[model samples]
Target: MNFDELLSHYKAKACIVSVEFFPDGTYGNIRVVAGNKAHCDDMASLNHPFEPGCPYEACFPKNPNFEEHCYCCVHEGKPLHAYVDLYMMGLWLNMFLLPLDSDQENIGYCIYCYDVTPKADSSAMADLSADTAADVLKACIKLRGSGDIKHAFQDVVEDIRQICGSDHCCILLTDDEKCTCSIFAESLRRGSSLYPMARYIEGFYTITETWPGTLAGSTCIILKDERDMDKLREQNPVWSASLDYAGVKSVVLFPLRHGGKLLGYMWALNFNIDDVIKIKETLELTTFFIASEIASYKLLNKLEVMSTIDSLTGIKNRNVMNNYVDQIVEGQVPMPKAVLFADLNGLKRVNDEQGHVAGDKMLRKAASILQSIFHDGEVFRAGGDEFMVLVSEIDESEAQRRIDQVHYLSKITDDVRFSIGLSYGEMDIRAAMRHADECMYADKNAYYMANPELKYR
Candidate 1:
């Protein structure tokens, strides 16, 4: 066959790929047998001049996913198309593969054509088979239509598991700063022996960190058989051993990314190998929407925390304290067992003598002492140099012990003193707060009477 002539018909960069076929349905060497002008130009630009019958890796990076596609296209005598993010290259690739008629025995041939862009093209991504399009659309609807994002993610993961005919599907979120990974959502096939991912999540981020290296610049990882698993073993022995222990045979893993940030990863275990292309196609688009939604959800949570958290003291702010009081007043929540008001005894003197920076440090020290003592309670910054601690489901004796501990700790710290007042037993939250405030003032007056030299209004 005139391979170059065949490739000349494609305006996009195109090449002829030949695979060494075997009788047992396995392949040997895969090589780039020929290339058109555009493909040759690309190779030359990379300093790897086009050579006939060179191993595919000579011209392009070695990718197990690409090898699988070539083998499948040649064996099945069908066409394959894919739109993938080449994250390593910072490019999006639109690729097409079509089986070609071959004359040689024990050899198969296919035409691999592709184009690249610096950014994702929505039309190229949406170009999918009807069934795949429907599946992706369903996932998008589930992600965007639900108010509870976590529950919506659960539904989508289950749907993805069923679509892949897999035993398990999971979305694992990664925190690089904390070096931790958490299962965002997961679905396990009924009666499957596969254990939940939560069992292995402890210290799993170390294993996840190795995935990008194993993927080797591909968009995702697909291990359809033992041969691919062997490659994975060579690439990541620790993760492979963990999978072996967990009884995972075949798997597909995709990194969920949004706005150039890696949010997490999505994976399926023991899926139907015959539907690899369909599964890849469906997830390629579905993960895009999922990552976007996850980014939005995380941003909203950060905003909520900023609004309700004290920036300086690193405790709940007055807004949250007010809301809790409202909840208790309206009978929406149980009355707290104890309320304690802690006012810094000499903040005004410290600010006037030393400056506001020193005063701020004193306030932080006070908050830290209160937090350490009432670690089980809600600690709030009610006002400048003032903090509130609310504890529920605790006996009066325990509350008093905690308050005593607070006083002892504060007394021992340098230049740190607290005039603390406590109200124990169930009562109206407003009245409890008023009583605590008055008691705190009385304690403050006593402190000033004892140390008039340090007193300031």
Candidate 2:
């Protein structure tokens, strides 16, 4: 029952460790309670062997920011065959933990360690290091750059396409909402004319919804040839049909995940090799880093959009306006510009007669009108009932056309009542803004005077 006696009966490589569980479902302190001399010699980082209450994780040197796989074994009560490489020791350790039967409520874990260092140089790791470097460099250049996302990702996909012996590779970035998952970006194969599987994008079986029969839900779904495709067809007819129609004899899909959420799926079609080992090895080498880059890009993009857009009207807000003015005024993007200042009429009347909800619809209507009129320019929801359009590098005829379009559209509906004031020429952004703002107020004053009841507005 004592530590030394318990250690004697187990394998020479085995160790007993105590792991403290936190309320957040994550393990905290991992202390090695007992181990054989051989286990201590290998695992113990210091000159002297670790005492009963010593940090297990720190003692085992690992990659920085490395998540311990042993946590899942102890906390989730799931048995796993996982290994960790102690870079300093150059020894790979395989872990197995069992729940200890102790009087104490939280006695922590009793782990068994087995070193698999001899098997580290197996043929399965064949050419992985050599292959990854070439792919990683090319992928990093494409993903990290400011090139168009699809185009950049397409280039990244191309690196893996031929490397993995695939005819085509594409990354489909997906957006998951409450009841649906939609493809946000499709980095399709280069020189491909039509999308034979385009129907599935807008069809019955979306990726996540159709494929939920895996451990991580991000598991690789590999279909080799017609029978394999047919088997999937019965499971999800639409998805299978689409795949078959595309004339893809073989396919492999790996879900690109960040944290635990699936961002999208990277897929390869009709590769030369059906050898699962090669396919898995190739994808395993590439998909992870690619997925991480994709996740960072998407999260950053979402943040940018949230900062720039008006949530209600779905138009560019003051944040965008500030950036636009700063660029033009600072001479960053020099061009002849036009500032069309627009204000909605009867917004106050609607807010007073009907509540703010109705007023919101009126504001949306006003924003829609502005967006329609100034389709070519950057339209901003400047204020509660105000809009501003910034058109850069515009000539007189183009400027007149934009202004004329606004004048003609304002008379279309009683609900969309608004006044527009434009200042267009080779001028500074601030001066144009000021002139347009003044003209807008002058136009507003004329409307108010005509309708005396709304004189205050």
Candidate 3:
């Protein structure tokens, strides 16, 4: 073959790749045997001058996925294409491979071409084969059309499992700050021996922490056979041993990331290795949408928490308390057997003598003490320096004992004194709140009568 003539006809970073064929159906020494001028320029720009028959790693990074694609293209005699995010380089790569005629018996050849862009092109990403496009589009519709997000996630994971012909599929979310990982959704094929991920969730984050290093700048990890597993054992022994113990022979793992932050991981265990390329293509696109959805879901949850929680004291705010009251009034919720009102005795004195900062600290301390004592009840920051506790079921004796304990605990914390009043036994919650307020004022009056020097209007 006139390799130079073959090279002169092309334009966009094209090169001829040769793979050494073996009798045992394995490959060795993938090399870039020839290149067009554009490809040579690319190599020169990377400080690696073009050398015929140089190892593929001489110019590009060593990626197992790339190697697999090259081997498959040469042996299978088919064209292949992939659009991948090169996160380490902050680039998106659109690549293609086409098998070439080779006269030699011991070597197979293919032409590889690619283009790079700083950001993803949606059209290029959507240019998928009909089957892959249908599969990915179905997942997208399920994600966007469902009101129940958790159920939608379950359905999508099961779809992925079926598509991959795998024993199990799982989406695991990670919290690096807490060093914890949770199974967001998972589907296991019936009769499969794999245990549910929940059983190992106790310290799985430690294993998850090792994944980035094992991936080693690639976007995913695909262990298709024993050779790949051998490489994984060298890269990550702990995870490899865990997979071996779990009876996982083949797996595909992709990280769920949005805006450069890693949200979690999606993986399939014991998948059909014959369709590795198809599975990789499907998951690459599917996880992009999944990560975006998960990020939005997390943001909404955080906003809801902010709205319902007291910012200063970290307790339920008055808004949530009002909603609970409405539920009780509507008979949607059972009436509490006990209601207690606790008013800070001398917040104004603290603010006047020291500062509002000190008064704020005192309020937080008071809220903490109330939370510790009424752990079984609903504690709310009802008003400025006032808190309310509602117990769904408590006898009068136990209520009085808790009230006495609160008084004693407050007395010991000289800076945090409370005028507490309790209404025990089932009644209209509205009436209980009013009675508790009046009793609280009466207790405040008694405290002032005993210690007039510390009293404030």
Candidate 4:
């Protein structure tokens, strides 16, 4: 297409917004004259593919700024310019109203719009009129400002269901660790036969043949109606079966994404969004932010787990033990009525003779043995091949019995042997720790004496 051809195509295809105004500076209905197709081909380039004969109020629904802007141009009798940022529409529009001479001498103005959002979301258009965009933002703000902000996906979906007027709203969260899609939230038609609410509350669903999506390599999918069922089924048979059973007629899903990474999927059922363009624009505003928040939440949780857990033994680490000690010091815990320190035997030998991998296996096995004996107590991987158990509210007799059981189990196993030192009825944590450490060494010496073949540095 050459320049003139392209210009002609643009003039005919570009979204053109117009409104008639009264001489008193009041405006009549804003209408779509032409160029709605130009609005859909690219997101940032245009706006509402306004249906013919639709009022401006319908486009911005419930908002009067569009009319007022046109009225300003009519009163000025010259081209007037304005800037509007349609955030939810993913549009930063530079709008210009050119005064037009009408036959009846009534005032009229035409709008020229251009999108200004960053290029990340260029593939889609947020053809939401300014009013609709404002409504979407207010809902988002309400969600963010709710006094008792619920981090649950349910809260967000419920909020969206209201704004989108969908029969149902659902969110599926990605559990990367388990590679599963857990139903995070759902706000369905209260009595809808489609996937009764109970199914969503049934915990996680595995990411298998039963799920949906073939990773369309895109961020959004709109299933207008039954016509799209074939592709939907082709992508995920299991998901298709569930949808069919639920009596679902239509679906609109957006991949909760960040920087091209899909965090999960949020969708609306039976919505038939009156203006498909606006829904796309509205989601383009919220879904990615939702994805980013969830991603951050997961990252923080993973970091918390890593900080307090021992990767090799899958038990609390020294940091946790220190916290426990601090709790005792602060009287948060009852000074740990009993303290037991245990050290694995022959770990150095295992590491030297076999390998670090074997040593890791041995360490894990030893930790398990310690955990099994002190099942009722708090266990910690205090150091390399060393474990600690702090038992509170336990009588001396019970503590002794548990220790004897540990000794009996240790004697029955050759590889999973450890020395334990117990200090019972100790109110001062420091005294118990010292006494227990000394006792552990004494036991370690005796074990070596009995089994010289297992002696090590």
State every prediction's TM-score relative to the real structure: 0.92, 0.61, 0.94, 0.67
Candidate 1 overall lDDT versus native: 0.91
Per-residue lDDT over 1-457 for candidate 1, one digit per residue giving the tens place of the 0 to 100 score: 8887788888889999998878887889999999999999999998989999999999888887788889889988989999988887888889999999889888889999999899999999888999999999998898889999899999999999999999999999999999999999999999999999988989899999988888778889999889778988988998899899999999999999998899999999999999998899899889888999999999999999999999888999999999999999999998999998999888888888899999889888889999998888999999888899999878889988887888898889877898888888848899999998988899889988999987875
For candidate 1, what is the total of clashing residue pairs?
A: 0
Report the error of model 4 at residue 396, Å. Answer: 3.4
Best by lDDT: 3
Candidate ranking under TM-score, highest first, comes to 3, 1, 4, 2
Error of 1 at 80 (Å): 0.6
Off by over 4 Å in 2: 1-152, 178-208, 213-218, 225-230, 330-338, 346-349, 391-416, 424-426
Say which prediction, candidate 1 or candidate 4, comes out ahead on TM-score.
1
Clashing pairs in 2: none
Instruction: For residues 18-136, write the lDDT of model 4, one tens digit per residue.
Output: 56666554466677454444544443334644454556544443433345456555555655443433433444444455665554466354544444454444223233467556855
The deviation in Å at residue 438 for candidate 2 is 2.1
Each prediction's whole-model lDDT (CA):
0.91, 0.66, 0.92, 0.67
Model 3 segments more than 4 A misplaced = 351-358
Tell me the lDDT of candidate 3: 0.92
